[model samples]
Target: MNNEISDDNSDMIISDSDSNSEESIEDLNWIQTFLEKPGNQIFVEIHMQYLTDRFNLVGLNKYCSEKMSTMLKLMTDDIDFLRGEYSSMSSIEKRMLDKECAKLYGLIHARYILTYQGQYDMMTLYSENIFGKCPRSACTGTPLLPMGLYDVPEQDSFKLYCPCCEDVYRPAHITQGLELFSGFNGSVLSEYKRYQQAFDYPVEKHLTLRDSELPLGKNLDSEGDDLNIINQVLKFNPNIDGAYFGTTFPHFFLMQYPNVVSGEEKPKQRFIPAIYNFDLHYNSQILRYQELKRQQLEEKLSKEYDPKLIKTKSKKIFTSKTKMYT
Candidate 1:
């Protein structure tokens, strides 16, 4: 089965490359350039929406919080161990301790993903407070020109840069924190500079398969096509990165798999929307938005509306007053 799967994947890649090769270079170039744009607002909006999507936001927050807690626990364990071993350590062992400390710093530097219902909105607020606008300025003379969507650091709320002018800026509080963390030592600053260089790189793009080619089920039709299942497996398998599949004779046959339930029936691959749509993070965001809206509406009505106005008729009261005056 493994041999068959490998052959199928190889064939698929070849077929995709051959088919996609005919695609216009101009279109590809435009896409690449658009992605390259600093502070590409559209991409930022899309990312914000994806982060704050009803199902993904909650899941992401929970996942991040749990990871943070786990990391803290591990750090505590490491510190305890280090304290026990510190006094008797030789020079080589002390060097190992330095390596351990560096590892800890790296772990701390790992990007933290925070999901919020109003992530896009929050980004705007942060931009307004720090850089004056969320959109990158097109003016070459403007300091904001260099600041793009990618310039925004994950987890850090205060640090920002102008992509156009290559100017770095941070909120006062954030600067204070950075000062405390660095203790005027150049090591943290050097690490941050390296991180910025890495963070500026383009996001990796993955090959997306169409619905018809997605393999998610265990059923085949009369003609016997297992291409969908093969494709789905390939998509989920992170190991297949930078690999291509070919579409030749024996390679096509690699997609055909025997049905386990009833040997006589070939199972067709079915698309599963549930797998992709089941983002816990997004669902939590939707719930949070609903709650927020509800609260806002309630507050508005309570403060702005008069209950007495509903009970009394202005026209009838005016008529009564007129009669008394007459």
Candidate 2:
């Protein structure tokens, strides 16, 4: 299992005997430093295929024009600019360019995932469980899918959900899990929001996970509290076999239960959000994508696609035609 990655995010490899082929760590310093970081690593050689059309990145012109140019050149294997530009740009400018290069890849990624090929490619990744497996014991390694609790990036972070368990897990112990798999925080966390500082390795200081920042299906509940203490499961209860009916009416299990809010019996420890994925998926993103496809198809087909556009006229001479035949 030397090459087999663990769900603990691969840090469990306590020791390694491999030696570097090139001993001078300073050699190829920039390339080494860049490769070591997760920023542009997601774009890797695989993303170079997308650099052919800058037009696909229609709205990102304002980030860093020069860096974007550098990105294109780099993807095309033209490092001559780095060697040729001897004294013109400041180091700060160069740094910004590097930053924007990653940014540009991210912008393209958003468009890329929407393409037919991109979805299929991601589907393969999803099938492989590159996002990792469901953490619950009962799930017994259900492959996870990348999901955002909220579509509007910053409000909530990405989660790994198992359709079988109908539950969500914190993506791959958070940091190493994401970078190694998510595509610099993987495919889902791109363009919409900046990568979290948790992925900042070897340089940026560590960050502690907060109660509010805890993964979905997890909560900070006191032991004595009745609602939270009963059985700390937040999603479909892990104890039961068929707890997940569907995302619809999330509060149904708790809402219908007797004396949940008052009286003798203690309540089930489930909480419902004011807004949830069921609303966002069916009511927004999925519906929006479908509507967008419909619009595009209709536009391409023009008026011919619309049967409503055709007018039906009453035939006043129908009786006269019958009389002529008689």
Candidate 3:
């Protein structure tokens, strides 16, 4: 087994004369030029050996046709991997090889972003709002993350994930359509930690409840109903942290004020919404409220209507209709 592995590695090494060949030199020039591109500099540190390995490129052959015979050779300029006569190929043929080479790089990029360094780089981009920001007013322009709809290449385009709304949206940037897509076989990568970090901005400017508005020691007679309503909404995600309440359950505040209070009075720190949190639109909120009331009324009426009585009445109506038809 060791002997076989050594032979394979030795075969992958190109002779000095082969390295100086026209095709080999051209491959070298292409690689150098590609790495120098502004958008491709991130891949410079990622070695060609890993990128061209058969194990890492299991399903990428489907994207490349037979015209580009030696994919490994095109990428690494290694003579041992060469099978085709790239030196004799026409200009159009060389262009096809370049395109295939780029596709391979994209496949490698999908793998790269899953690495620690890649994630760090992507996190930096996330902070800079390079991917683009959520357009929903509730999200307050929180930076979006690129996520593949399907792990398979060319299966689906990428979507923008909003940590604030905890939802996905079609990206606004046209060029971003060809962006990051996962090549991982199983589950897609999780950005839960990223979401937590990106969503920590203060939201006091958007939502603030004065001590007077809080139901803690306020007039129980007037604020009692309001407290009950708040408690009911809170029940939707009982285990949710106060800071992320709006992410789980959307709401909005018409008025805003700083929660800070002066010397003798300590600020009553209630659970204020996060800046990168979802706030339902006012009109939609109204519709939802009416829908909830309608559901409650139906539930109340349902208890009075016996299922057995309804079934009996349906059977009698069926019998009358059948007799008339006969």
**Top candidate, metric TM-score:** 3
The count of backbone overlaps in candidate 3 is 0
Computed on alpha carbons, the lDDT of every model, listed in order, comes to 0.30, 0.39, 0.43
Candidate 1 lDDT, tens digit per residue, 1-326?
A: 22122433322221222222234433322223322322221122224234223443232223232333333322333444333444355655443333332222222222111223223333442333322221223322221211212211121222234333334443111111121223333442343343234334232222122323447752223222333222222222211211011112111122231121132222222222345567466666776676688679867776556666644657678889999999
For model 2, the stretches where C-alpha displacement exceeds 4 angstroms are 1-49, 62-67, 86-91, 147-157, 165-168, 172-326
- The most accurate candidate by lDDT is 3
Query: 263 in model 2: Cα distance from truth in Å?
Result: 38
Lowest lDDT block of 10, candidate 3: 248-257
| Backbone collisions counted per model | 38, 3, 0
How many backbone clashes are present in model 2?
Answer: 3
Error of 2 at 230 (Å): 36
lDDT of 2 at 139: 52
TM-score of 3: 0.41
Indicate the TM-score of model 2: 0.38
Q: Is candidate 1 or candidate 3 better by lDDT?
A: 3
What's the true lDDT of residue 45 in model 1?
Answer: 22
Model 2, span 1-326: residue lDDT tens: 33222324221111111111122322323333433332222211224456577667675666446646666654344546544661256656554555455445444554565555655555555444444566665554555545444322113334545555567665435222332323332232231123233323332111111233467766444322422221121111111101011122212322333222232222222222237434544456665666688678758676645565432212335666788999
